[model samples]
Target: MTHRLALLLLLIWSTPLRAAQEDPASAALAAMHQLEAATVALEEAESARDRVRAYTNTIRAYETGLAAMREGLRRAATREVELTRRLSAQEGELAQLLGVLLTIETAPTPVLMLHPTGALGSARSGMMLADVTPELQARAAAMRQNLEEVQTLRLLQKNAVRTLNDAMASMQQARAGLSMAIADRTGLPSRFTEDPVRTAILIASTETLAGFASGLSEIASGDIAGMMASISDQKGSIDLPVQGAVLHGAGKADAAGIARDGILVATRPRALVTAPTAATIRYLGPLLDLGNVVILEPQPDTLFVLSGLAEVFGKVGEVVPAGTPIGLMGGEAPQIGAFLSLSGEGNGPERSETLYIEVREGDSPVDPETWFRTDKDG
Candidate 1:
């Protein structure tokens, strides 16, 4: 009994340590480390940290950390449920085994060795038990391992909510800082001066998205001397403007049976949207049925139209570099209960807000998947 107990303890200690190392919780810890590092650096820099670039990175760190934690918690919960199911399925066998082990534990070694039969029969029975020792040890080790894992995963989830709350607070601060920084931004070269009268006239006259897009150049005060470098070579390599799930591909119909020329991405509440490359903003305002739109002219006769933003940033003629924050998707952040309940079903991307993306060349709308790097590329 003593030897078996020692073996069980040894296996439990070794296996859980290794399992904990490779578990989903490690990802959350890694992300938390990154967030802590970014925030610490931002604090140490003080004045230097109050820039769009710094704030963007900090916001990203917070998002990554929070997402990792949420995913970890969900996976932990699922794993715990599975382990419990497995243990329950084997409950009867486990109970009988435990009873036998307990009986053996309480008995003296001399009595256990003695049997009702003669000495030869007793020796034979002891040899049979000896033959089965390894199997019993293995079963005990497996049960112990499962029990320990369930305990560990539960502890990870129990502590994660508080950490997530703190991270969410820091993320909001980063976003606010970025908003203020964008408001105070300067020195970005302009491709052309904006003509509000022509823009307003175009808006009032246009009835369709194509019509508005075709006449967007009229809002500019004539063509500027220089344009940003052509991005023709970078097609299919551009980063996605926002982190979200793709609800529908270009030309893919929704449940309502309506199809559009652009891809629909469902973003999280208040998710950041950015420019995929260097481009001149040609138009940024409400247009037709779409919400706030930011039109970018990356080259001659080419347009990248991003719509459905809660708030637009920059003027109509400013040139924004790659990955510059352009706008934000609208919606309120989730409460703790709602967040845990809604997030991490392993279903798909967060769908709190939706962004519509369209890429037009010459005069016709094309598939956005042709231009952006997607998960499929991986």
Candidate 2:
């Protein structure tokens, strides 16, 4: 009874140990399956709304699954080392057992039965042989299990690499499609014309972002007080000009380590930049330290400045409706570098660009986060 109880306890403990060893790989596989499902959903989505939802889900799932994969790979590496050591030990034990078996088989019948210490020595030798046999069998079984585990781990690692490649490709395709959609939708007419003389002056005289912003504020004449008042009333409920992730919030340092007074959004190449609210294009020109910039006046004292455009659509003094396209993000399609640097996952060699936005009330910068709809809000 006591021997049976001891065996039962050993079985329970060993079962749990094996289960714990397998848990990480199992969990990682589950996460990868979830990510695959999300990517499929993204690929199958027909509408913009559905695509956006699926894309968000895919991003989240990919991140989660990637983390799990990394952890599982680390654990597998550790397990491989342990298995190698155990297999070596088991091989040594098996060799010793074989040597003993050979000795017993080759010995004469009388010699096997006889002992130096008479009958007591013979009985002790028989008991030791009985004990060693079961241990040898257990070691063989354990070695086999370890070999199987190592094979499984190698297969998992290979699958993970393939899945990661597929995921990155899908992300790139989705971003490109999104950029095309935005460009197609941003075909609004310019209500005003470009002022080349003023543009040149703004380009030459504006030494800093603040100076450029001040110049833009003075360029346009105020019009339609009622519309401006209505826009001001909806201060905190406005949508951003471009649809993408916020790379840097207001007052955050940019890649150049300069603290910006506005928000920086990382979006797909050639993404359409639009007017957040009903505003007139106060200034449209390239200034020092900023790319092609577009300034809009929603009211007499309120100005919205957008910079880093590849192409400007609106002209100076153009009165654009809310959600009107003003320009496009500066970059060619199929950009092979970091699309969104905020997440820090560069998504292969395709790099996305940034659109900088600043809202000013008579030269004082306002936090765009309070006004613009963020990813959380979307």
For all predicted structures, in order, the TM-scores are: 0.88, 0.46
lDDT by residue (1-378, candidate 1, tens digit) is 133333332332233234445566665445445445545534432355337765665565555555555665666667878999999999999998888777766878888688888798889988987777667778988999999888877777666677667767777777887888889889888888988999999999999999999987788787775774799999898888887767889999966799999998878888888888888898898988899999998888899999999988888889988878889889987777766665447554346688999999999999998998776410
- Which pairs clash in the backbone of model 2? 335-350, 336-349, 336-350, 336-351, 337-349, 337-350, 337-351, 338-351, 338-352, 339-352
In model 2, the worst 10-residue window by lDDT is 335-344
Candidate 2 lDDT over 161-214, as tens digits, reads: 666667556655654554454444444344445556665676687678778777
Give candidate 2 misplaced runs (Cα > 4 Å): 1-24, 47-50, 59-119, 126-142, 184-205, 209-378
- Give candidate 2's TM-score: 0.46
Measured by lDDT, the strongest candidate is: 1
> How much is 57 displaced in model 2, in angstroms?
3.9
